[model samples]
Target: MISEQFDLSNRLGRGDRTALGIWFWELDRVLLALILSLLAIGLLAVAAASPATARRLSSADVSLPELYFFYRQFAWAVIAFVTMLVISMFPKNMVRRMALIGFAAMVVAMLFTIILGSEINGAKRWINLGFMSFQASEFLKPFYAVAIAWVVSWKLKDKSLPVYPIIFAITGFLAMILMLQPDLGQTILLSGICFAVIMVSGVKFWKLAALFGMGIGGLVTAYFTYSVAATRIDAFLFGTDGITHDKLALSTLSAGGLFGVGPGLGERKYSLPEAHTDYIFSVIGEEFGLLACAAIIIIYFAIIIRVALRLFEEKDYFTILAVTGLVTQFCGQAMINIAVNLGMFPSKGMTLPFISYGGSSLWSISITSGLILALTRRNPFMHKQGQNRRYNR
Candidate 1:
């Protein structure tokens, strides 16, 4: 059986008749493993966080199970896994077309969200869809990245494509929509990803400088205009006793020391707002220990480094830009979420990818990961031929 497995893995030729066979030979299995590991860790972290969350929300009139959130997250994980696999199997052109359609559709959904979405925590970012609420911005992110990459890469082929202005217009339009939803976190994320994509497309220094200036100005405007943004910033800056989440998160990590309090033994999660979502890293620390937290960080870094290194050799301009945009957004969000947990950055309401407990977030990231895997796959036969020559057996 082991030999058969090896044969299937090592022999990438005309005899391989299965889709899974091709995928097994071509896919970045290490990256996939790392992603699955993070998801597994998320399940454990959410399981630890769920009991308290359930109890806190439960009332005499509305009793709930302790594992309520855990169960729901598990279901979402299953769905997300299937979604990622299916998407990763799609051809490159299909992925491109999918992104174009998804971007347009999500834009419409986001606009409708502004009109009819449910307000949650002062942001109209989610549309209530009977069974589950959807955050359109989450879905928009990867699609937007791909679409921008498509347009910018065209400019690479034909110099007169006016790519920079088109990039700016699309980004500006998205930023306007995000600010209307008052989703500053997603706004900043979307802008940063767009800038990175444009930068890689070899934009002029002045153009990059202008965008950076605009980003800074946007920050200042957000600080003054958005009460939530202002409150978070002020709390981070001047309010000694007001950095409640940060303080608690740091304290929680300290409590775990090296190993942890063990599984569901995390008491600090009870006091942590959005423990299973935004602050899930802190829960991992308190329950699973600093070692577990370090492992998660290592996995994230490995994935990012692996993708960035892979892109170094890629020759296609669109593949380079799109994958770079996707991976940058992936790592950037991870950094923001983890930084917020560690009190390094002001709270951004960003969920840790594959871990944070949001259905839309989980599914959206799955789509992003799927696209990355699809774009990054090498020709299996090419890879095999190279391997054979290197061995010289």
Candidate 2:
């Protein structure tokens, strides 16, 4: 089996018609290209933001390179791209199995994180793994979506199954733990994923209405309960705080106006906190211009639309739910990050999907892209009738 796999890979590399080659041809190349485009833009944005971040972080004891974050992000991007490519080659069954297993493992990891995680900025969200710190929630997001989709897809097998309740319970538990970590951003993202999945699963309109109501109520509760959320919300709504991160972000974002000041020429980014991670969108605005920011948003919309179009005729329940959930998670996060950067939403320490600097986030997003590619792969020559026959089974 190993030798056969190796031979197939060799044939794929040589552009010969083989199993691997078939996989490549069946892959959603347009979606892949869009993802890669974002990755490339992310690299440039990181490079532009790196100098300010490095300088701010530098001290008398240690001097860091100007492109410190950029170099590290570049390395992670290479690894992430390779990981995505390999995972995208997996068969559908393997993709589902991996998500199930990964979801289970990440749940355990999240528990460990709550118990023994390193505290950063008053949030215990990272587990130190010697070489690097691991954020369980980041890795858990994609897997959670796939797992939920897998569970909810069971309705087609038996309409009487309590799949919705099961999904809600799982999501609720996850949300509770996330709130314990005080990660309101991720909690909100996951809730959105669950809501999107349920909505696509044919739940009643009134039920979705109730769910949305609950979500809003939850936010209200968080405002009163979570100090971080309250502070940020107050800052956003009332402008109670002077020179907050959001204010700086908006100022930095518009500093370049339409065409930007050119890469690394913006001076405002130096004052913007989390410039390479959460506020990278603003950094891109400062250096790459508002036009680049608009283009990035368009690319995100294109990716979401591309996936929706691909799933138009999909008959498999799991495929529809899983794909919907993943894309919702992807674009939803991007929208929040962009909104926060524009001072339209409260500051959430959420990284801009593929355009932010973080090891775990980069890898998680790569996995998301890979799963999307894997689930959406189809033979171009297959007739609609043949495709339906295959999916209906």
Worst 10 residues of 2 by lDDT: 8-17
The list of candidate 2 runs beyond 4 A from truth reads 1-16, 384-393
Residue-pair clashes per prediction, in order, are: 0, 0
Error of 2 at 380 (Å): 1.1
For residues 186-269, what per-residue lDDT tens digits would candidate 2 score against the true structure?
999999999999999999999999999999999999999999889888878898864389888999999999999998898999
Measured against the true structure, the TM-scores of the candidates, in listed sequence, are 0.93, 0.94
Output the lDDT of residue 65, model 2. Answer: 99
Report how far residue 118 has shifted in candidate 2, in Å.
Answer: 0.5
What lDDT score goes with residue 202 in model 2? 93
lDDT of 1 by residue, 92-179 (tens): 8999999999999999999999999999978899999887889999999999999999999887678987887888899989999999
